[model samples]
Target: MGSVEIIFHGAAGTVTGSCFEVRANNKTVLIDCGMFQGTRSLEALNHEQLPFDPKAISAVILTHAHLDHSGRLPYLTAQGCHAQIWMTAPTADIIEPLLLDSAKLQAADAARRNRRPDRMALPPFIPLYTGDDVTSCIGQIKETCYGAWNELGNDDGFRLWDAQHIVGSASVELKLADQRILFSGDIGGGSAIQCADVPLGGYDQIICETTYGDRTREPVLISDRREQLAQYIEEALGKNGNVLIPAFAVERTQIVLEDLVALFESKRLKPFNVFVDSPLAERVTRTTQRHRLTGYDLFSVPNIRFTHDVEESKQINSMSGVIIIAGSGMCQGGRIRHHLLHNLPNARARVLLVGYQVAGTLGAVLRDGARNVRISGHDVPVRADVKIIDSYSVHADRPALMQWIKDRGPVSGSVFLVHGEQHALSVFAQDIRKAGLAPHVVVPMLGESWSVSANHAAKRICPAREDLQVRIAPRDWTASLAALKSGLADRLRALPSDAARERVLASMTRALEDAESIRTIT
Candidate 1:
């Protein structure tokens, strides 16, 4: 058995920006390189040099495509670290657009500040990464299937499972000799139709998210959220004040669009123009459509006027009462901030938030009913009514999280609670210990190491199968087709009807093992 060291560089106390490094002797694999997006004091942390030399890192694994989980890659690659990014196919498709768009915005801001009217009087805050950086980062993708054990770098291997948070999201299980660690990037309950079937697995150690770990949100009935949004929009439309929604360009934007379209379809709303004002969101919608070719969609809403250029977006804002969905979901930075400045001072307008608003964010302050918020170095009075639809949060609640853990059986190693606020982690830690685990709880601080004692380490070891881990299938009879089915569903889902007719038909044969009940972590 080998010893491994881990560091909790980000997402330790506050949420947003998740990064961790696992070191096994000289080899290290970093999981998730998300950039911090919040207050300048905190976001400045990303601008500081990486804690460890990026050059020493061997490979990187992505939990999902959320900016908090994968945002910092362009900076990492630009600085050093030329390793491949391992993730499921859906993750690969989404990351390209996200990274590229993020980089473009960063470059634009840098240019704008240089030419600002107050350039002589004000100091500049440069963007963390550039478009050139994203171009390089997107080329390093290596897609992996779920539920498969495979070697990584020189001395490590990991098994991926369906996390169901996002299209390609997975809970990663890493093996380094006798030690293994499981990372829960962000988990999704079966609440949304797009989430894949949750998979059950074994792990020696587990690191999970506590975004909704503190409270069991009473199951948010879909009807309630729809009504909340409809009521807000209906009122705003009646006043003819613009409704500015700061939406994440990924699943959040798509779901909101879906809800709006549903309202339109049901004749519950008027024929007002809806503008999706993020270029990235437009591409992400295409990615969503690509997934639909396989018959899976997380609320496919159609008919949006995608506005990319600044002038076009400005024009939409100038023309009163248009519903605008813009990016940088939490309102930290982006064109959404510009749109907010105009609509927020108007009593007829509304600012709608349908996602988690982190602390130190304009969205959070607004959600918490702040009368005024500072944006772009200016404090603006809040005249527009702000509405928060917390039910629409993509992160599963406490009950859902608990069910997912229960379904995974007795994970016999150290379980670390992460990707949540300190309060959330504290409460969940006690509950985890109650589940009868060996050294059940670990809340790792930045750069903490967990090494195994030779006396306590397990002796069982599997021989390495190098090339097959990356190939179509491993040359082993013990591995079942059912495991492969869940791992490569996207590939299978995209197979031609005639070409994969028999192979696809064979996958429908469920084994007795499939009868195992899924546990929810709510």
Candidate 2:
């Protein structure tokens, strides 16, 4: 057998964007081609040239339909990649609406930016991929079942196993020549109300996600989670306020709806109208219902209303004492931001955060207790009660990840960790060493490559990009600048007199001038 090489293209040092390249037997396949999220600098990476040639890839094995894991497929296809995209049936269905919605959002954002009076001499903005590109990408997708191995000729193929993270999420086991490598595609905590437990198997080498590797969540049962949701809603309603939930359109929305249905059926929650205020979420809910993936009817309840148009969404602003579930889970975009802009200043309103908020996103700012935030060019004060329900997260925690890794063990080669922040990756690397789960544990950097052989440990073949570590830092410079601007404004407003504020501004200007002069001298 010849040598096998794997490249960490994305999600190596960052929490989102999960693309990997695997090559062997004169064939090159991409595991995923996702988009970077969070900071603007990170999202800008989506517009950069793909590190590898898309035309050179023979096939693409998708792990799931979450945008971070599948968003860039259209961009790949736009760049002339005609490779067959393989995924579970549900992912194939879900990605249609997801990709289309993403294209629409990008186009709208670009148009909005271009229309701005302050755009000045900046070049006209363009979306990364258009709806026609999404159509082409969708045409290339081929559906596969969960348990059967799909042959790729020359004794190379792959099998999909349920990841239990979402409706059709999966972990992939790839066979190339004589080597077997398993890719843990975002493992679930195994307690999700909508999905089943994760399956275990042995592999020669493993590449796992470490999204929650540094922290262990408190164990929560399905009933307990629902109860907590009920209490939060009730508390908010008691104050005669609406409960706003910023949820992802996929598993998070479905799971929240499942719990809500249970609570309503059991009469734990009083009769209150629950609005699902995202068009994409409504589409995903219908897809899940068609698949019969969840035990509960996600959208058929009497009190549940799925708003489909801007008019319907705007109507929610006048309502009170209800629960609103909106998408763009990080509160970065989508209807959630609109909801927050209207409700955040209301002292009676409650903003319920039920998913992981990457650093520098609006959700993280709220989660970190920012008293005021800039939204849609308006500075909005955050007086609404912000509460987080960690149990609602679908990603596996440290304990679950360790158990999953151990269950897939007896591996004779290295176990590579990806899809985590720098600190989580560092902590998980040490944890794997202490547990003795594998002979070697590797934490790959973005764009790094490794050579693997059946008889030897995986060895690094190339160094990662020099600026990758800095680029993937928890908070980017853009977020810092925004914070600095907000803080400076607040400080200026609090000055005793206009003269004092003027003096502060002058001093700041002199300081910047001096700094620029020093840089010029250097």
Compute each candidate's TM-score over C-alphas. Answer: 0.81, 0.95
Residue-by-residue lDDT tens digits, candidate 2, 1-522: 567899999999888889999999988989989988888888888999999999999889999999999999999999989989999998998999999999998997888778877675899988999999999999999999887778888899998988888888988889886788899998985542222353455578899999999998888899999988899999999998999999999878988988898888898987789999999998988898887556777656889999989999999999999999998999988889999999999999999999999877899999999988877666788899999998988899898999988988888788999999888999999999999998989999988999987647899999999877677777888777667766678789999999999999899899999999999999
lDDT of 1 by residue, 236-350 (tens): 9888888888999888888787777777778887767889888888889889778645322433435468887889988986687679999878987788999988788899999
Strongest candidate by lDDT: 2
List the candidate 2 regions with Cα displacement exceeding 4 Å: 191-201, 293-295, 518-522
Q: Which candidate is the best by TM-score?
A: 2
* Residue 180 local lDDT, model 2: 86
RMSD of 1: 20.5
Give the lDDT of residue 241 in candidate 2. 98
